[model samples]
Target: MMMVQPKLTVVGAGPGDPDLITLKAINVLKEADVVLYDALVNSELLRYVNPNAEQIFVGKRRGCYRYQQEQINELIVERGYSKGHVVRLKGGDPFIFGRGAEEMEYATAKGMDVAVVPGISSSLAVPAYQNIPLTKRGSSESFWVITGTTKQHKLSEDIRLAAKSNATVVILMGMGKLSQIVELFQKEEKNELPVAIIQNGTTKKEKIGIGTVDTIENIVEEQQLSNPAIIILGEVVNHRNEILQVQRNINSKLTKSA
Candidate 1:
C-alpha cells in the first residue's frame, strides 16, 4: 500500500467566545488525530475534537512560555507528519499577530501539506462588542492595527505615526505599556482624544475602561485591566456610550412588554 502523506491544518479559534469558532474549524477539529493549541484559545472549543485525538497545551502567556516559538515549530512539523492529521489551533485569526505564518512556513518547508482556516480576529470583534466602530463615515476614513510590543519588548515606533494620523488606532497586547502609549498620544497633542481599553473581550470576564489619552492609563490601572486586552483610540470611542444608551432603552422596552 502507498504511504499517505500526513497533513497539517492551522485553525483560528476566534476570540474568547467558543461560539465564535467557525463550523469549518469545528469540522477540522473533529477530524484531527492530534491537536496543539495556544493559551488564548478557549478550552470549550476542544469539546468538538475527536475523543481519541491527542490534545496538547502549548500556550504562551505573558512572562511565560511552555514552549518557545522554535520548539512549537519543530513540534508541529514532527507531529504533523507523524500523527497523520494534525490541527494547530490558535486564538483569533492566525495571520493577525497570531504567528500563524511562521508555523505554516516551517511546516511547508518540511514538505508537509498545510492549510489555514481564518478565524474572527479580536482586533475588529472586540471593538464591535464594545460598540466602538473602527471606521465610521465622516469620522474615520481609515483604521490602523498595531502591536503594542516589539521583538525587543519595547513599544513599536509605528505607534508614533499612528498617534499622529487621523486613523482609528487599535493596539493589541498593549496593556502593560498603557502609560507609554498615552504619552505618545499626548506628545501628538491628542491628549483629549477618546480611548477605551477592553480586557478579556467577548468573554464573561469582559471589562471595558474608557477615558481620553490623558486619563485612560489611570482608568485602566484603577480597573486592574491587564494584558489580553485591546486599546482603541479615536472619535469612534465616543460612540460607545450612545450605543449603550440605545441598548438600555431597548432592554427597558422589552422588560415592560414582558
Candidate 2:
C-alpha cells in the first residue's frame, strides 16, 4: 500500500486587503482540505477557499487569546495527517510577525511535509499605503520592526535601542501598551521626537494619530487608537505630513484643470 504523504502549507493572508493575496496562496487555499486562520486574517480572503474546505479559527486578537500555541501546533500535526491538505493561514507574512517558524517546527517533529508561502508583511505595506516611507534617502536610511509582545508583553531590547537610534522604529501589536512604550522614548533626551500611530492600516477603516514622543501617549488616549495597528517613530514620520501636502497640491491642480 502506497502511504499518503501528509503535508502542511503555511500561507500568509497579507494585510487587511483581500486583493493583496498572492496567486500561489490562492491556489493553496483552493486545494486545502482544512484552513486554520488567524484572528486578523481578512474575511474576504477566506471566501476564496474551496467551499468544501473545513475552516478553523485558531487566532488570538490583542492579548485576549482563545487558542494556545501548543494547541495550534498539535492541531496542525493531527490535521495534516488526517486531512488531505492542511493550510495554516496567518495575517501578514507568516514567517515575519506571525509565528510561522514555530508551527513549522512542530509539524516537522511529527514528520509532516511542510511548505511556506510568503505574503506582504504589514510592517512594510501599512506604512507605504499611508505614504509614510520607512526609509528616506537622506532624512532616514534604515528602519527597525519589532514586536510589542516579547515573552508576555515585556519590553524588547530593540525597542530600547531604537529610542536612541536615527532609524525609523515600527512596532506591531504595540497599541495596547502605547503608554509604556511612549514613556520609554520620552524619557530619553530626544523626547520631542515625532511619532505617528496608524490603526487598521491599508484598510478603509484606517486612522492616523500624530504627536511627539513626549505627548503621543496622551494623543493615543485622546484618539483611542487600537491594535491590529502599527506605531512609527522617527523623523521619517514627519514626511507623512509633507507627502499629504504634495498630494493635496496635485489634487488641487487636477481640480483646477477640470
Evaluated with TM-score, which candidate comes out highest?
1
TM-score of 2: 0.93
Error of 2 at 221 (Å): 1.9
Q: What tens-digit string does per-residue lDDT give for candidate 1 at 64-117?
A: 999999999998877876777889999999999999888888889999889999
lDDT of 2 by residue, 1-258 (tens): 655567899999998888888999999999998999998899888888999989999988656767899999998887877776799999999998688999998898899889999999999998888778999998788999998878766777788888888899999978777777888887787787888898988888998888888888788779888877899998888888998899999999999999
Q: List the residue pairs that clash in candidate 1.
A: none
- Give the deviation of candidate 2 from the true structure as CA RMSD: 1.8
Give stretches of model 1 more than 4 Å off: 1-4, 248-258
Q: Residue 174, candidate 1: how far off, in angstroms? A: 0.9
| Model 1 residue 82 lDDT score | 71
Model 1, residue 54: distance off in Å is 0.7
Per candidate, the number of residue pairs that clash is: 0, 0
Q: How much lDDT does candidate 2 score?
A: 0.87
Where is model 2 more than 4 Å wrong at Cα? 1-3, 253-258
